[model samples]
Target: MTTTGTEIPGPAGLPLLGSMLDLKRDSLGTYLHAQREHGDVVRITAGPPGLRVEIYGVFSAEGAQQVLATESANFRKDNPFYEEVRQSFGNGLLTSQDTDYLRQRRLVQPLFTRRRVDGYAASITDETSAMLATWRNAPDATVDVAAETTRLTLRAVARILFGVDVESAVDVVQRSFPIIGEYTLTRGYSPANFPRSWPTPANRRATAAMDELYAECDRIIEKRRADGDAAMGEDLLTLLTHAESDEDTPLDASEVRDQVLVFLLAGHETTATSLAFALHLLARHPEEQTRAREEVVRVLADGRVPGAADLDALPYLTKVLKEAMRLYPAGPVVGRQAVAASEIDGHTIPAGATVVVAPWVTHRHPRYWDEPERFDPERFTPEREKARPRYAWFPFGGGPRACIGQHFSMLESVLALAMILQEYELEAVDVEVPVSTGITLRAAGPARCVLRPVGRGTGPA
Candidate 1:
């Protein structure tokens, strides 16, 4: 099973394109196919033939562990893909590596501690309830669940993380974030010789969106500064502005802006996409939906809305969400460039090559998961999970660089799903929702669902 660098097998491509076109057209399919045909350590040459980047696609949990955990120190985030990310968001935790990443991570770590994020449960539930109330008033029973969750998550993250109500900013962000993400993807896959500064239409649009986003971040920072510590409430922005590291210097204006932008983009987009997929899955499987709803009803018999305290009581809901993530992880692939030559299972990876560890592929690899394509929430039960390798189901990634906001994201998602299940039952109009693989995996089209009110007794007229 082991192979040297030159012996790695891959799909042969055209003389010039070298699989770049296939990758762009259907990245997820290409990766899945490569793993299926070429084995765990598949070599994919992308971009122009003469100027291509050879990406080592790792499809097994063992390979993933090597890249993300065991030999993680030999791998760094300074890859072609993240270069595009840094151009937009700067050296925030997501894009930074080495000392910069460690320093910034330490600065923001306090804000996301379990105790701190647990306190936001009230705000999360309130926002979810408000969103449900809006759905109740709508004339059409059918709704674009993807758009609805995006709005709900944006409002919740803004109110709880930034201590500000950014309803107006949400519209701007929703429109611009996709543009930026698409641009980043394009840049990542473009020919190694291509110049990023070229004034292409996509590049121009990406620059404009980045500028607008930065301006909004600056405005929020300035408003918080003007209000002083007295107006500072119990939100992430307050923590960021006043946070001090061992070095004793607070984050400067630029650092603050980068952190805000990174958190805003990441905090809302991933959670919204995951919730949309969860609802889509539930709609397709009425039995599972009923199970989740029954749990909600049993847990909240006192008729109080679900909150942080009720999270443990709704294990099925949590399982359903976890299963959805396993199938369609928010960040389908996490990449790192090997700073030095490394060997994964005896497959020699040369220095500076991109090592891609994709949860989308690994979570579904036949060797690790049973019925990889099936939607089974029980796969996440503690007993079942214990039987699998730690890296086999890393929706939030693994290693020290794992997502910092995972705890917060889980709490927010659980609360929202519980509240929505209590109010409406979703019926899928399209059983298969198309997926778009950009910076994150998202529903490419509207996840259209007919919302039927639950036992509250108001049926769609």
Candidate 2:
């Protein structure tokens, strides 16, 4: 239990390049190998040969708890890596640190209240129903479930949270989001790349995409403001514009813009990716899929769409989603920089060092999960969950910095899954979909599935 930096063991990387190549080539595999070789906490060098960066990989639930909860204050999000995110997303809640983050959290917390989120359930089901209608028109074609889910979630977020129809902007978002995400990841991970200020082709393309995104945000805000009180619905944009702190200070225009942008990106992307993975898993496991469908049918026997109140009754759907995230958490890795020297599991964490808590690794840690690699929804059953440490299954992360849209994401996911299952049965065209990780975890390519209409043979009435 002694605190000694050198006491912690890790692979001695190749000279100069160190582990940077391994990280660039396969970050997940690199972390997994480190965990297998050097226990829970392992150090690895990143960055370039001349300016290598050292980061400690924490792979155990206890270590995750330490970094994300108990010793959270000693760690801060003010790292060089987050600068990339800040450039694109601004100082929104996701990338803000310290007092600024605290203030923003308080200002926005009211928007995610259970009452507010519950109100969006109908919109979620309606959006899914609309998407299903489109799917039904071409039931026999090989549909890209991943792309379709992304579209569904984006539409729901835009309408439910912004109170505006973004049907036209969907194509813009679909084209820009991936480029922006990939660019941000490159800058964050490989700092040696051309400076963002450089007018390189890739940089120019990313900048153009970002500009288009910001312009759309402005358009939404301007349109809402033009509508005056009539547009002042309970949507997130209204809440952000009208929000005030205890001292009665309101957020500035720039602040509102940043917040909206963050919500637009984060609120939709993570949920969409998770849903795609969930559907992919279900398609591969027919028994699990049938069990989930039965639960949906039993609850909604009258053929009504699922609402927030129906959530509790849909236990298996929740488990299937939970298990899907366990295998492929939307946010696979979470990072923090040690603000001060600390000790975790007896290893000395020096001040200013990067501390990583990867759910991708911890969720699969052999010590915590039984048959770690297997897809088993039973792992999330209440009794089983109660038996494990709280941090053992943190797909949404832990602590104050956890996702603000967790409840919203869960409701959207559950409702969408239920509605889709009730209408159509999906068969996997390719069960072996590979994962690609950048800002979030996603299927490397389209998760193709052949859709078959339920016995009704038509769209929902």
Candidate 3:
């Protein structure tokens, strides 16, 4: 892993401040610009000399693979962002490492198998239908696609995860998560900040939010346990309460709470981002929308809700989703801390340096994608996909720590899209929605869409 190499190239910065101001201004743009100007492996330094922070950027597909997969162990989640997430949300799958991560992954893996996740498709269908029903009552048949999808995903994931206690969990999640997410981002990036113990307004708000969130999860878990519902159904909360591995013990109450928080955060936000952007992109491109709708009609004829089995039957629609994710990855940037000095794409990344594998930039790598800005689902056709490197289009991440709920995410997205397009024809009211990253990619403005019921001959009535 070690090889002598030239010093990395990067943007020159003002004394003491380094590139801090540039990153603070626009993190996404700074990453993209750095790649375009300094090549794949660039050094990004911030802060003054005594407290300097250096980030190593890995933009190539090959380098991304190395950081996230090939040499994954060496690039641990020891970065400030991950630490911030752990402090705000407990150390569940997204933040845990070493043996703790392996143990948690083993216990949680069976719950996310294709068969188990597919069983929740009915929940996704019910939620999507409910959302569409509200759309029918919208004035002028228009809606904010981002806001609606966020509600849809939140309700669906909450229902599946909390079962009978869904209502209690949903309210807490809706009210609390945004506060914690914003607080984490602010503190995660700043080199120095007021301690969480300080009675600062932001600290107090974040603490209160976390307290409410934790209390709700604990109450739900207690109810699930006392009711002896672990054997009554296979809901995620129930499964996690009794989750076990061949040689490991079941998770305790605190551990269960951590896992629940992770699922609540990961399950809803990422899928909502994909769905919102997918519909927005489709509305802007009528031809692609028509093509996708045609596929949806053939697969779910008579407005039948798509189940897990139906996913494979709707290839074109799936491709459309893939393209949407490529353009707007939910987790735009992933960070890790290098455990040792290692050469990546001919540049040496020193030990303890913060390393970034930004899907936002890699997904648009000029060498891999032709007209990377264009929305073209055809690029994902089996033939075209086979020609590209695996890391070139990783939206859910990669390697052993890849997103566990990936299957569930795909199932939920495809089913929702199919159900929506089956009944409504969409036209974009706002084509270019501004986007920025928080815990996941977020729309900076309204992505409005006007919906018209599909003509009888065009789709199921």
Candidate 4:
């Protein structure tokens, strides 16, 4: 039983299907429009009769904090999208609930500490250098930064995750993730979807991709087990293999495979989205780009590639990435199911309602962000950051459920951006990158930039 407060406001919809068409047509735009038009909390209804779905949109930063942190116990990863992902992938950290989540978190926490992730910086630098080398060799001066960054982040994370087995893992991941992402998105949003056993084209493709991905991860895990201590190394896979060493029981073969699959999905995709958009944003703003490059060049004055130690020294570059993530968060909308009724902004949210905290909308809230659409890096300066609410600029979702790989993501982004800016001046060819939300945010079209080589001597340093 819950006390009734103010009636929750929302957009009126058609007779049977509410805003489903509008959402399916333009999900991000619809969310933004709802927040702007309907204050902070807006109800969105889809489906009809027995199956009507009501999604409570929490747009204010305060509301976001309540849902994700302050009243986190009231919410869990029990939404449709999470269920879709959990079924396709396994029950990893991203979708595990309660005790299972706690156990997984405890086992995996040590591997992602700042000190441990810092050790992977060399692998990141090597991969960044290789990516740059590919750009230099490309016949076309204009390259799609979105595709390039996806390839780069995937390879880098794969190498760190699989060690010697990265080669076999890379191609499968690259080819299968897009199929899986699309399938997840399409089915996750539809008010009604066909059964997997029905064997539609989409189902066949998604099923095949899932099988391929699982098979590959199992193969890698089996090989690592066969190699034993004689070939054990410091890669993520090795650490996971021994994850249970500290506890009473070890992670089983399926558990190891599930964790690896989640890592490959979350590790590469989110960071790749951030890097691509950061470069695109910089390319569009040459003055900001110049300032960022100057900072990078000055910090790495010795001309050595930036490692994890140098991350703090390049503050402006870090700000640039932060600002980009603010404008275009990779995980635009995070969903949770309410276990009990809760109040947000004087409104009573009924129990069993689906709730969403959109970083994409909250990051652009009119109250906290001045000129929310403007590209500004100074907004992230230390003094200014402290002045704002903690949840206001959450590119990574907040609370205990916050991204485990955040340090690694930042390390990869800042290092790769520094190295790339050191060698080339980027100019955008396609100024606007139309994006859509899948399992993560994705560029619907090409984000192409023309790269002009620059001399090290000519840099600000």
lDDT of each: 0.84, 0.85, 0.91, 0.89
Task: For candidate 3, give the lDDT of residue 235.
Answer: 83
In candidate 2, which residue pairs clash?
Answer: none
By lDDT rank, best first, the candidates go 3, 4, 2, 1
Q: What is the lDDT of candidate 3?
A: 0.91
lDDT of 3 by residue, 1-461 (tens): 33332368888777878998888888899999999999999988888777778888999999999999999999999988899999998999999999999999999999999989999999999999999899888877789999999999999999999887888789999999999999999999988888899999999999999999999999988888888844468689999998887889999999999999999999999999999999999999999999999998887777677788999999998999999999999999999999998889988888878899999999999999999999999999999999999999999999999999999999999999999998888888997899978989989899998887988443223
Off by over 4 Å in 4: 1-6, 245-248, 456-461
Global fold similarity of model 2 (TM-score)? 0.95
Q: Order the candidates by TM-score, highest first — what do you get?
A: 3, 4, 1, 2
Q: Candidate 3, which segments miss by more than 4 Å at Cα?
A: 1-6, 229-231, 456-461
Error of 1 at 108 (Å): 0.9
Off by over 4 Å in 2: 1-3, 456-461
Per candidate, the number of residue pairs that clash is 0, 0, 0, 0
For model 1, give the 10-residue run with minimal summed lDDT: 187-196
Put down candidate 4 lDDT per residue, 1-461, tens digits, no spaces: 33342357788878888887888888888889999998899898877767778889999989999999999999989888898999888899988989888889899999999999999999999999999988886656678999999999999999999998899899999889889988988788776788888889999999999999999999888888998997689999999998863654778899888898889999988999999999999999999999998998899898889889999899998999999999989999999999998888877888988999999999999899999999999999999999998899888898889999999999999999999999888889899999988888878899998888877443222
Ten residues in a row with the worst lDDT in model 3?
1-10
**Candidate 1 versus the native: TM-score?**
0.95
| Each model's Cα RMSD | 1.8, 2.3, 2.2, 2.5
Best-matching candidate per TM-score: 3
lDDT by residue (tens digit), candidate 1, 1-461: 56766688888877777778888898888888999998888898877745777888888898898898889898888787788888877778888877777788888898889989999999899888888888876667888888888888888888875666466567668778888887787777666524657887777888899888888778877888888977668888778998878864678879987887788878888998889999999999999999999999899987688778888888998999999999989999888888888878668888888889889999899987888999999998999999998889898888888899998888999989988888888899878889988778888998988888886555562
